[model samples]
Target: MVNRWASGSLAQRGQANRLSHGAAIMPVLLIVGGGLFGSQAAAYARSRGIEARVFDASLEGAASPAAAGLFKEAWAGKRLAEHYRRAIPVLDRLYGIRGVTLKNDDGEDESFQCVPPSAILEKKPVLAKVTAVGDGWLETESQRHEGWVYIAAGIWCQQFLPELAISGKAGAAFAFPGEQPGTIHAIAPGRQAIAFVRDPGFTHFSDGTAERDYAQEHEQATLSRAAALGLTDTPVMRFWGYRPYTPGGPVFRRIGERTWLATGGRKMGTIVGASFACRLVENELRA
Candidate 1:
């Protein structure tokens, strides 16, 4: 289903709204970040007998910029098709946690096969456990597909909402395509573009004009930056997210032995920060 949000009502919460509690005094989850990843982690911890608390100073970041530029990943094959293929696993993680589901008009199941990243940067590999819920189908990489759109990138806490997202250190703009109701299709840009990890530990891509680049690139600098990044203008949410440089990372750091130190998340204050808090709590519990 192609969905786009036509109205930004005050009462409306994006798909990432906080879940309600079952009873009073849920265990404390203590998440340090506040973006999408942070929210998901906090929600995950909460479901596992923890109450979530996210911390970040900047909420409005580049992802929210009005004219932030964007492009699709550098995929060689059918770009959107390949993107959906690659996004299945990540979406699976999100679905497992969020209990999300996607189906065709006839209420039939949908699936995608092995999807790979458009380009592999020099970043560490990441993984999550996989389990087949229904009849398995063979994807090039792995089978067991569920029908839903997917995009591959590092997850973050600040990716939750523009408000919770720490403000982007760099300014950017995004042109949103309002197609289906409540769905984010694509984004056009205007500046140098911003690239960094979000608070939750996922990479962020957006069209931005660097404070420094402004002098040289002028009004339409984001287009040049977009081309340089090799982005392909795929149908993903134009959310640039924030860069929370909160007092230096391991946001939940310790100064002494039997202690931990955390801060930073130069860009990813949400997920990393919240993860830091949860890790600390876990260590403390173990201690």
Candidate 2:
């Protein structure tokens, strides 16, 4: 196979394998949809071996490339943060996955890293259960890795809510390629987070849509944006529909008989999304 994502991380041990075998391999029911919450949750099911099928409306709606597979802890609140923190182990164990390109499902990762990334592993918790934790390609003591977290591309949330609501004022995003060579940069920062990237500049087919080209442009623009904002290298990503804005933030609900949904708010759903999937699995299995 061409490899959708990449081979499992050795540091993750057999966690990915176990997630697929233990969580997905078992008898389970699956429901797939769009919206940041549903799309990532469905992808989590697949990573866990749930073989959760997807129902995508368009190509870009389901966007995570290889980079999407990376995980992070860049959310908004404590409860949400803890919730994702709780979901990591379930994700770590879900190591063995195929059918990946450089990007997430949406074909974006190759624009970032080519080979499957190397992870620095750790101990993560699934509620009271301790599980293996695999960080992303980038290594740091903090879980908040400022990179992409591949989870079946941009996620399929847009399907359910085609007009995904955003908070920022409506504004047009302009595209620019860079000096580094491959990356493409499109910035449309606003008061809140109303930036609609699903329809990023390159949504339509283009001739020179190479990753290196886009990277060069993005890198240069990123440098300028950083300096203008008077900040060090800060974190910015596909914070579309429902991306967290708090230290421990995410989608959750304790209202009904017992149903909750959580994914990393930012694009780092790999770790955060997996963490939530584990909780969902545990609840289903335990129930």
Candidate 2 structure quality by residue, lDDT tens digits, 1-287: 01111234433423433564476323322222233334445555555555443322333322222122322344324544665566555544444332322222233543221111122111121112101112222222332111112222232322222333222111112222211112222233211111111222321111111121234564444345434422233333321122322233444332112122233344444445555556565555335
lDDT of 2 at 103: 24
C-alpha lDDT of all candidate models, in order: 0.31, 0.31
| Ten residues in sequence with the least summed lDDT for candidate 1 | 131-140
Determine which window of 10 residues in candidate 2 has minimal summed lDDT: 124-133
Q: What lDDT is reached at residue 205 by model 1?
A: 42
TM-score, structure 2 vs. true: 0.36
* Candidate 2 wrong stretches, greater than 4 Å: 1-28, 34-51, 59-63, 66-81, 96-220, 223-248, 254-264
Alpha-carbon runs more than 4 Å astray in model 1: 1-27, 30-33, 53-59, 62-168, 173-219, 224-242, 246-250, 254-263, 267-278, 285-287
137-211: candidate 1 lDDT, tens digit per residue? 101124322211111112232232212322224444333232211112123432223433222233344443334
Candidate 1: Cα lDDT at 193: 37
